[model samples]
Target: MSGMVTSAHAPRRDETERADGSPVTIGALVPLSRPGWAEAGRHLLAGLELAVGEVNDAGGIGGRPLELVVRDTAADPQRAAAAVDELAGLGVAALAGEYHSVVARAAAARADALGLPFLCSSAVIDALTERPTHRVARIAPAQSHGWRTYADFLLGAGHRRIAVAAQPSVYWASGTRILRDHLAARGASIAELDMTEQPATAVCDALAEQGATALLLLVGHPEPAVSIVRSVRQDPRLADVVIGAPAGQPEFAEWAGALGASGAGIPFLRYLPERLGPLGARVGTALRERLGQPPSFVAFEGYDTVAVLAAVLRDHGTDRARVAASWPHVAVEGTRGKIRFSRTPGTGVWQWAWPPVQVVDRDPAEPARFRILHTG
Candidate 1:
């Protein structure tokens, strides 16, 4: 019930769900809840399950269909490793989805050791591709990339002095570095602030002292990022400085509110393929019917991850090595856009899923206010 009827094709049943309910299936593992992320984890799982249903309804991969084996990683490296091993023991063709960079790395290593393809939908740290053991494909733009894009936007908007803030994670570090480099290359000056462990007040004070025209925030966590923005908003000199984000957060609007900031003159970058939405929405509907709601970003990623593997399987067959090798060319419509890999691993850039930038020049809630800055 949770699948797509491609406009070009009719809805069909997957071979996996025969009257007897047996078929070639795969497993999807996601970060289960740690002490703090129970709600987010559940949402991600729901999205993945929704994707599985849609794929099955569309007659499943090569007509064989798939069964999803679900596992919870608890967002811990040790636990994630154990869960992947468990899935491997079950002989799943491929695996997808992890939020933590370290946990994703461990999963990728295991997939490679076991000769399985791993598609990372959210992990954007540049180092994930450095693993020699696992074959991996990433759907999100690398951390450095989103930052560079934001820098370009700010420079174009006549902002020369910028302030940068980021969390301590691998993704945030790389993103902040890239923004610095881009600004320097353009002969623009930027004051950098690493919020790795600093209090929000200190960060805001640092940005205020810089007297920058804008803030380029790459803080990994939305809540703290919001806090930083709010603190800055209280400082008259800092409030007018435009804020930019490359990492997509669902609470971006709420964070803006907490900071008394508006998306006006703010820009956010996304790396998902363009046509991914219609398909993703269909999957969400089907998932809601059975699982009560679509999964969170994590679960949708898992579904996309499996879909990519299934596409490769259809094109290449059951050979795991071939599927890994063919990743650079294996393209599929995802929730964000058409997803594919770069021939050069770890480019920190994606060839597909680039959307035109939009300027938040007014209240973010205003309709048609998102004037296109660029188009695919």
Candidate 2:
């Protein structure tokens, strides 16, 4: 239950050491065993590894090589909190890497309690960064920001009557509420269906009966979204309905493949594209070579997470307090776009106010090839 791995002896640091004969260790907390998100964690680890290799190859931070101490959370909140304490016990200068929003919340609290600088890579819940502590910051935009992007896309497409299918989790519910409120302000009507209580076919039938022209999936996970898409496609009356999900983009291929030809033309919002900028292209190529596939936005976020940490450690050394204090003034151009953290009224403290995002759909013949529909 502790999820601790005990070695016979202390791990060797020679291979990871720099010219200064020391290693600046960073702790990476990711879910490697969650049923639906294990592959996502692996992809994110690939990105972190890629950035670590590049940083060490370039002489590291102030001649001290950066090392990553990875811990798997199993996508569980309690385990994630324990991982934070475990990493701090191992003497890591900072912490990063988390996929699950609920787990990220636990990790953030633990990191703050321990006075460690925690840079959240991919968790999008608004409350994670809203804590009273200055030890936490996030790279991903909050769910409200992402939902607004989707709302704009749906409204701009002339889809006034939209239907939403959402899971019962707090994360999904909050995101769905944002989407609903935003769309409602623009004179759009929306019907709701609870994914946990109803079957996908029944939900699709209800939406079709409501004269819905578009379906927005607020389910936080991919499997349910995929199932709903497949079920909706079975009815000829809903064939023209535009299906979109902001959270399903990371695991697009897995669920989209289940839908096969039916998944094409379905749009989802992604934070980073394959060829966003120079850094994006460079990381994308490295990921394609390492993972044997294109990099997801989560991967890009992972890479940039390390990049930002390295920059801070280089200038501020490994002092946790200094690193956390320096985040407010830290601003740099990253793979996706400009990377900066700011405190906004509704969003949590030290959250990335805006990150570049795009709506893309899979090419029917080639699922790997995604065509961009809109950008914000």
Candidate 3:
């Protein structure tokens, strides 16, 4: 259980409660500890906690206080699956929150087996399940959808020859395929530089030789990814090459902290509209307070996850089947935009169809500021 875990019932002074007095519990799976992207997890947890707090304050599910039964996934698939099984056993109405796609897939599979409702918050893998299951739905944009948009951004920027510093993972592989297929259709080609085999300097050597105009960081953060960015930025031979992270690595403060000016001008994917609507503006302000830093897109995804689930739980009640059934019926105003789930083709689960996608980079002039380069 997370430190943020609320008791099953802790109604406010003015709030009402059910006769049973049991809270409506949500299972929250976040990568909070080592080996996981803990910074992203903190932002994600902040959003989830903030939304859960607001839901409780605004009168929880039918007077019963809403609660989160939090679990730390630690970025391990097996750990995530185990957590899902445990959460299902704990009688949570649904599961939510995870930033890593592979871990989310593992949790999704377990949730499907247990017939537990799961509203995945931030993982963007296209195939979240081995097959379609009503029990699992997603709030994030599908990898195919977001990555194709990223490919178009690269092409429109006139990068004919692109190289990716890729690690071994299904998520990275899927992104590579999406970019390759989309870019190839427009007469551009991609080269893969395996991070497992090459050092950062070696990648620069290959980029220099290939004369690639872009190098996408399709690897993990701060280690190989940060090192690669440093090496590429230092190598004058590849000075003109654009560094990109279609996976949205640089959206958090840690990326800028690690690479500073070198991290600037490196474009990454972000899911946000050109401007926030009224609800979004309010939530963003609240989230900034909750997080003590500007919230990332993942934080919005967390808030939206709760917003959608709370609507379902309030309208349809806490029956597991009803919550699962409520995915198609959801139409809640979220922090980003109107969020609803439907069966998107090839997604194998309920999807939001699309969240706004943008190609953004930390401004070269001010690394703390982000500049949107393209939108889709």
Candidate 4:
């Protein structure tokens, strides 16, 4: 567990000259073995690899190649903590790349205990960075940011009455709460339904009966979200209801497309659409060449995390403390837009103040032709 799991692309590091001449190693804790998230983890790793390759191609940080030490968390909190410990034991300078909020929480604690710099890539739970830590930062926008934006989009679309079918996970629950609060403040009527207990058909019927104009599917996992979408689409009475989800954007398009005509026009929030900026276009091109698909939001986060970390390493050396201290002042151009960190009251730690996001609808006829309805 104290040894590095080297990839073929990673440069070899001399053990004797590790202090000054070895490759700078960063630990990546991702859910590589998780059932539903395996493919997502691969995409994240691909992004990390692309960034590392780019950095190395550009002469790396101070002439030392950047290398990744990856571990599979399986989306399990205990496994994530253990992975952090393992990476720390292997002497990684910093830690990054986690998709699940629960795993990020445990990994953050372990990273703090080890005094290692941790830059969360995509975990969006508000409490992940709520407390000040000497070495924790996040590149992803907070849940409130996404939820508030979603609420604004709903209100702007003239959706006065909205129904929310949400899973009970912290990711979904927190998002639901934020949406509810924001919509309530804007005088929009809200109906909340638990997706775990209630049948999707019953929920769809209830929303239709209540004259709901939109259905916000807050299910965190992709499979369940697809199931709900299928169920909702089965009812002809609910055909006019605008369906939306905060998680699983472009990836869910394929699952939605599996429903044939039923999934044609469902909308979802995407954190970093490929059409955002020049950097996004570059990332998209690289991803398509490498993975044969456009980059996912998680992939964008992975690339940005490594890109920012490389910049920090270039300026601050590989010292974890220095890198952590410099994070608050670090700003780099990300795939979606400019990446910057700021201390927020909600998450009383340095985190990406605002990351670009967009609302995109699925196009069953052409999954690649997903339409962007709103940008933020």
Top lDDT model = 3
Using lDDT as the yardstick, the better of models 3 and 4 is: 3
Q: Estimated TM-score per prediction?
A: 0.76, 0.91, 0.96, 0.90
Local lDDT at 179 for model 2: 82
**Which 10 successive residues of model 3 have the least lDDT summed?**
8-17
Tens digit of per-residue lDDT, candidate 4, span 116-137: 8899998888888436775888
Instruction: State the lDDT of candidate 1 residue by residue for 1-376, as single tens digits.
Output: 5332121221122232233433544555566555324444565556666666656878766676555666667767677777767766655566666666667777777776777677766665666744443366676555555556667777787988887776666656667677778889999987778776788789767766777877777674446766766676667767577776656543233333444434344566543333346787776555556555433344555556666766776787645576667776766876655666664345422223432222233245652233334222
Question: Deviation in angstroms for 88 in model 3?
Answer: 1.0
Q: Backbone collision count in every prediction?
A: 19, 0, 0, 0
What C-alpha lDDT values do all the predictions have? 0.59, 0.78, 0.88, 0.77
lDDT preference between candidates 1 and 3, better one: 3
- lDDT string for model 3 (1-376, tens) is 2224753443332232244656778899999998999999999988898888888888887877778888999899999999887777767888999999999999999999988899999999999999999989998999999999888899889999999999999999999998999999999999999989778899999999999999999998878999999998888897799999999989999998898898999899999999999988888998898788899999999999998999998898877888898888889888777888889988899999889999999999999899999999
What is the lDDT, from 0 to 100, of the residue 229 in candidate 1? 61
Candidate 4, pairs of clashing residues: none
- Winner on TM-score (2 vs 3): 3
Give model 4's clash tally: 0
Q: Each candidate: RMSD to true structure? A: 6.4, 4.1, 3.3, 3.5
By the TM-score metric, which is better: model 1 or model 4? 4
Q: Give candidate 3's total backbone clashes.
A: 0
